[model samples]
Target: MVTVNEAKQKIIANTEVLTSMSMKPSESLNYVLFQDVRASISLPSFRQSSMDGYAVHDSDITARGTVLEILAEAKAGEGTMQVLPPGAAMRIFTGAPVPEGATAVIMQERTTRTGSFVTIEDFPVTPGRNIRSIGQQIMKGSIALPQNILLTAGAIGFLSGLNVEEVSVYRKPKIGLLVTGDELVQNGSSIRHGQVYESNSLMLRAALQQEGVTDVEVLYAKDDLRATIDALDELAGRNDIVLASGGISVGDYDFVGEALQSIRAETIFYKVRQKPGKPLLFARRKQTLFFALPGNPASSLVCYYEYVLPAIRKMSGRSDYFLRSVSMPIERGYSFDGERDEFLKATANQDVVIPLDGQESFALRSFAIANAIIYLTVNQNKVEAGDHVEVHLLPA
Candidate 1:
């Protein structure tokens, strides 16, 4: 068995960022940019009016109540390249291009209009007032967004404004999940004696979806070694990552480890010195990564959050892939002397964290309400009421 740190390092050393693909910026939300995105053209490529007012030169408005003749009207999206005659004003609306020699746009509310003329009010009109200058937002041929930034909705709109059609971004990975155990029965089915409703598949699928991974393939396998081997082989052949829940521990019915070996997959690590998920397994077959979690629902989920999720994040081009952990005081005293490290499901605030009851490997009630996982190291098991401890915050 390897230490938790060693296991994590091994996973990191083996994982690589996936290849980049060209996708439309609108469809690239949550995907990390593989390269810097440069602006194709300067935003607002022309002098634009920012208000529904008159476009005029500095001399057009010499004093309050100065009346100027309206040469022509310019609406949004219409050309206004014609020069404004001397001492004349052009009726302009928001987003309309400004005519040549026009230095300012007086808002309509601050002016009174007569027949074919507008009278400037007492409001001071300065040069370039209410005008959007060319390239006001972004300059042409400059880097609009840096590499490795996650694209949000606002970023997508910004890219569209810059006329960027497609972007190079790291693609999300395709995952394959294989659930094992014959004692487990599907939900909505008749439960016979000694049979329990299966929930790991749905739980794991929802977890994967939360990470923006939707292209998942799911399969079920019995305790038979051959069935397990076949299911794993099929999943590994079609996915970038393969996950198997159950049949990892050394038991008469456990066959996940044997099946992986039978397929000639390289075992990166067999177990970690941790409670609830000590029998976790990580391996690789060619380019596809594999993880076999314990059959217990809570242990399976804990392993997924700690190990599998990080691997997915790395593969999807995230640099900060590990869970966010911080040290905080415990709300109450707790004592445990187990040889393996323990991860207790807990709810945490900014000041302190409270470890919830029902932390057993199969319990899920506490995990359901947990927002954080309080990590207790193997050797340092005793914790005082106010002692600071490491807490890993779960993604909301």
Candidate 2:
């Protein structure tokens, strides 16, 4: 078995980044940029009003209670080409282009408009106040967004404001899920004496959705070598990444390892020296990467978060793929005699971290309430109260 760090390195090194594609900004959320996004035109291409106010020459407002002639009205998207005359102001709305000769804007609340004249009640009018200069946000022919940036809603909106319709981004990988276990039944299906509801796919799909991965196809394979092999072969051809849950451990029904071998997939690593997911299996065939997670619900989810999610993120061209980690003091002492390193479900606050019970691989009740995972190294089995521990914060 390989150490956790070694396994993670191997997975990252072997995984290939998907090719880039041109997509609309609306459809490119969560995708990493392949090229630098340069601004085609300057943001706020014209000097714009930032508020619904009066645009006036700064010199015109020499003192409080200054009166100026209302020249014209400039509404957003309907600015006039007429320049402002000296000692005159324009009724400008937010986002309207500031007329030439105007150096300042005063809020409507601070001014009293009477017919064609307006009185500025406030003193010391400042230049460039309440006005967004041309290219204030982004200069034309400059980098609006650097390469490798993850596209979020704000990024998309910014690009859209710059009139960028399409973006070149790393394509999201297509995924295939193979669940191996005859004892597993669908959630709505009638259960037999030995049957259990199949939830790994559901949990994994939801997790993948959180990462902005939605193109997933799920298939159920009976605990038979031939069936597992056929399913693996089919999924390998269809997806860039294939996740197979269960049938990885050395059990009578375990056939994932044998099936992968029969299909000629190269095993990068068979197991990792970690609790809850010790039997994790990683493999590859040509361009397709495979992860065979442990059977238990908590084990599968843990392995997915620790290993599979990183691989998926890398394939999609993300820069930071791992969960956020922080060091915190344990609220209470905890003792364990386990030989493998464990990721204990826990809740953490700014002050302390409290390890929760039901940490067994099959137990997920604690996981449901956990906001973090406390990493306990194999060599350090016992933790004293107030001792510092590394915690991996979960996504909210």
Candidate 3:
């Protein structure tokens, strides 16, 4: 077994960012941009009215109660141009194009209309008032968004507004899941004396979906070595990342290790010195990455969050690939003398972190509600109330 830090280092050293692909901005949510996105045309291409008001030259409004004739009206999306004569106003609505020869816009609330004329109450209307100048948001031919930025909903909308149809982004990874166990049965099936519900696939699949990974295929294998090897071969052939749960430990029925050997995969690390997830395995075959996680639900999830998730993020060209760590005060004191490092499920906020109950590998009652994981090394097993500890926040 290797140290936790050693395992992480090996995984990072072997990982490489995936190639970039061109895709429509509408379908590129949560993807990292591979290149700078430039604006082809200035935003708001024309001088626009910011409110429902009258458009007029600044000199036209001479007095507070000056009455001016209301020329042709200009509504939003009006293609034809209307010229505002001197000493006259043009009726304009919000987002409407400012009529020719008009320099100011007075909101409708500050004026009263009678027939074809309007009286202005607010005096000394400033030039360019309530008018959005061309390219006020972004200039044409300029970088609208920088490279390496994560695309959110707001980003997508902004790009769409700029008329950007497609963008280059890091490719999203496709994963394959292989589950190994003869005693595991799918949920809703009747359980025999030694059988248990198989929940790792569903739980792990959901976790992957939260990371914006939707292309995943799941397969099951029995305890037999040949079946395990065949399943591993099939999954590794078509996926960028292969995930296997169970059959990693030194048990009699375990066959994942032997299966990997049969496929001639290069093992990066076999295990880590960590509680709840010591039997973790990471390997590589050419460009594909593989992780064999422990069978227990809680242990499997912990490994996924700590190791597999970061790999996926890195492959997708994200710089913030690891779990965010914060040092905060503990709510209660705890003591443990475990031989390996321990990752305890906990709930935390900006102020404090509280380690929860039922921390066993097989128990998930606490893990289900946990938003963070409190890390405790073997040498620092004992903690006191109000002591500061390292906590890793989970992804939402």
Which structure among the candidates has the greatest TM-score?
Answer: 2
lDDT of 2 by residue, 1-396 (tens): 998889899999999999999999999999999999999999889999999989998888889999999978888887356588888889999999888889888999999999999999878988998999999998999999998999999999999998898999998889999998989999898999999999899989999998999999999999999999999999999999999999999999999999999999999999899887999999999989999999999999888888888989999999788889999999999877766788899999989999998999999899889999998888768989999998998877
lDDT of 3 by residue, 341-380 (tens): 9999999987899999999998988989999999988887
Task: Kindly give the stretch of ten consecutive residues in candidate 3 with the minimal lDDT sum.
Answer: 333-342
Which 10 residues in a row give candidate 2 its minimum summed lDDT? 73-82
lDDT of 3: 0.93
| Candidate 1 C-alpha error for residue 100, in Å | 3.1
Each prediction's TM-score against the native?
Answer: 0.88, 0.96, 0.95
Clashing pairs in 1: none
Off by over 4 Å in 2: none
Clashing pairs in 3: none
State the C-alpha lDDT per candidate.
Answer: 0.91, 0.91, 0.93
Write candidate 1's Cα lDDT for 1-396 as tens digits: 998889899998888889999999988888899999998899889999999999898766768888889989888888447688779999999999998889999999988998998998844678899999999988899899999988889999999998899999998889999999999999899999999999998999998888888999999999999999999999999999999989999999999999999999999999999997999999998889999999999999999999998999999888888899999999999888768889999999978999999999999889899999998997669999999999999888
Cα distance off (Å), candidate 1, residue 93:
4.2
lDDT of 3 at 237: 93
